[model samples]
Target: MEDFFKGRDTGLVIDWTQMPTYNTIMAVAAGAGLIFMYMLGRALVRDRDFRAEGWALTAGVLGFILTATGLHMTLEWPFATYFPFDNIVFGEPSLAFGVLLLAASLFLWKRGDKIVAAEDRAAEAAATARPLGIFVLGMGLALFGIALAGLVFQLFAAPAEEPISGIVADYPMIEAIFMSLLFAFVGLGAALFPIALRGFSSTRPLSGTAKLVGVVWLVTGIIFLLFGAMNFFTHIGLIVNTMQ
Candidate 1:
């Protein structure tokens, strides 16, 4: 029992090569990236048809997955054997994003038909904005705080027990900075959403700030997708190195 506990503490209990869970999680993250890209693009193109139901369903499912994974990480600290701070760095943001996405999904699912069928969709959406909009804006603020924490703490020093850290063991600081920027992009987009939502409600075009937010999401999405894809290779290498 002591040996088992020690192995768990040292991150030696699990065989890294046999566990491809990180790759799977990264793939889900890539899908999430694609969803954000599509959502932001649609928002940018105000005249485009709203596929609310489809997107709502997709986002809800993904949001649920992220929420579950994040909640587990926070409560159980699965992979953060050596550095518990890793749990906060990865878990908190995931939880925030997941909750917001789930809320958005629910809003769309409940009001999708009304939104789609209305002659003035913006007005319909505007009428529907109450607690949900406020909730999202608050979450946006939380994400921003998380981003700031990541930067200030230099969480890139995360130990090898964290999979991504293992993958970039040589350039931890660079990876940390890049990841911090990505979170900042997402946080900025979320924080600016209410302004854009208000613009939509008033039937005004997307403001410069709103358009910039869309662009930020686009860039972040692309980077996440690429990073997730690249991890399939790099993560495997990490595991193999661990085995040796």
Candidate 2:
């Protein structure tokens, strides 16, 4: 039994060829990003009724998906080979984001009625529930740090990895910069959440900062969704290239 188990440990037990797990991860993350946009927009609208429970529930579902996948990627280092650090870059942040979303969703579900708007709910929760707010803010800061690292460290141009590199063989630098910028965009949006939450919570009225957060999330959502969808095709190319 020990000999047999040792033989199995030396080889891959699971097949990844048919499963585009990385792409699925991005797709789920994109979905969560879009939900953030919707939630923010709904919060920003003056006369609209913010359905905190429904939206928080939806976001929680996506958060669970991200958390599961992110935790796996971080711990197992599934697809990353040439650059194992890449897993840390993507996985840790994803895990943190997922946890934040889950936490926020739970709080909103419980004390949602206390908040008049989505922004208010967050701000109110932060004001009342210090820990949750701080956690969200910490995640936002972590994302910002990631964005900074991507820029300062030039993570985009680190190495021409598989599918992404193959897809943008012609314009590698451009695509790399674009990808890095996406991180920056999303990070900026997240970083601003605390500011928006605090600013609007006090006045309990629509504020410019909140509007800015909405715009950022909306743009981030569109870009992330499109990028994630495009990866569906590129990931196939990766599989084919590897097979060849």
Candidate 3:
């Protein structure tokens, strides 16, 4: 019993049962990254504030670094990136990469601050003052509606394997169905954004491809949160028993 407890603390051995708790960290990392990217992009494009956007992007890069490292460390290599997952260690290289990001961001920020003309700045300020609340709100509702439609489809159309089993299962069908659902929901959420924007009480909030980015992000975040939470507590009785 003592050995088992020690193993859990050290991460040398996994319970297999508590996978959900650890994956909560991944969901957070992904969610936070998505939101930050969209927010900073908005500020950069609308305000033309390079310094702020650069720093924000730098921090986001750091987050991805840490999150990717965690994933590699936890598994052999969950993602198929070129980061040499097998060799990623929390060592000098990681620190060096972070330093590099900081330097690049600072350089861009300084350059951006210096280049914009006064007239451009004035125009940007005017643009920022315009109300976008109604536009954003309508988009949010549409994304939710799309996500709900996904849940309804899942409930009625076809059966899916239990969450954990489907995740690590060898069966191709289970994995395929789940991945299909992921694409379905994400696509619907994105596609619905413009349609929702058109039907808004206001004429139009804004226009561009990036307009729907946040809607897709929020929908994805909710989906991950739901799956991670469900899997986490699936074996709650076992969790409590182990604690005792």
Candidate 4:
């Protein structure tokens, strides 16, 4: 077991100066993603009729915020070198938020039966509850799965032996597999956004701003999926080049 473990070597260092400008762009995009997710979550939760929907939206928003913040720090933080855990593992703040969101989501799921039973006594209540339930359930599952996977990858994945070369080399195949799974989960969440929006629109009379936000979420999710797919291709290209 000791032979399988290696001591950390600080000699090799990540050269942030050589990092591409696009990394900054990615950081900004991640920030925007958080803001947008938060806005959508707020809109979903503001109505009294959508309690489940609200909690679900809140969980999703919180999860995205955690993910985006983590990405931003990884990509754009200048002082990452000062903190030993900065890049060695996921950012502590982000991981906390992710875990919180997952807990809230699970809470909602466990209490769903009681809520559904109570709403079944009235026709209007049943009608509204059904759609909200569906949307909330879908969002909860997607967000919780994504967040848990990320947290596991960050906390338990082996660290690199050398600091400068980064952790990618420590467990390259595991990192690749984890990244692929993460992106696929994100894509799954994105794909469900429009469906949730449509369900919300059908069941409730959203304000003009809320409707616009829904549309933006729908469009942005599409764009995010496209960008993610491109990233996948780019990774594949890099792998091929490395092999050559």
Per-residue lDDT of candidate 4, residues 178-238 (tens digit): 5435444444544454444443432345445434544544454455445544554454443
Question: Against the true structure, candidate 3 has what lDDT?
Answer: 0.42
Candidate 3 matches the true fold with a TM-score of: 0.39
Pairs clashing within candidate 3: none
Choose 3 or 4, whichever is better by lDDT: 4
Residue 208 displacement (Å), model 1: 2.0
TM-score of each: 0.75, 0.73, 0.39, 0.32
lDDT of 2 by residue, 65-101 (tens): 7788788878888655444656776777677777767
Q: List model 1 lDDT by residue over 23-87, tens digit each.
A: 34644563464456446345425656677887688778878876877777777776554456656
Candidate 4 residues lying further than 4 Å off, grouped into runs, are: 1-101, 118-204, 242-244
User: Which parts of model 3 are misplaced by more than 4 Å?
Assistant: 1-21, 45-58, 61-67, 70-75, 78-180, 183-208, 222-244
Which candidate would rank higher by TM-score, 3 or 4? 3
Selected candidate, larger lDDT, 1 vs 2: 1
Which candidate has the top score in TM-score? 1
**Candidate 3, 41-102: lDDT as tens digits:** 44544554445555546654655564455545445533223223223222222233233334
Model 1: weakest 10-residue lDDT segment is 1-10
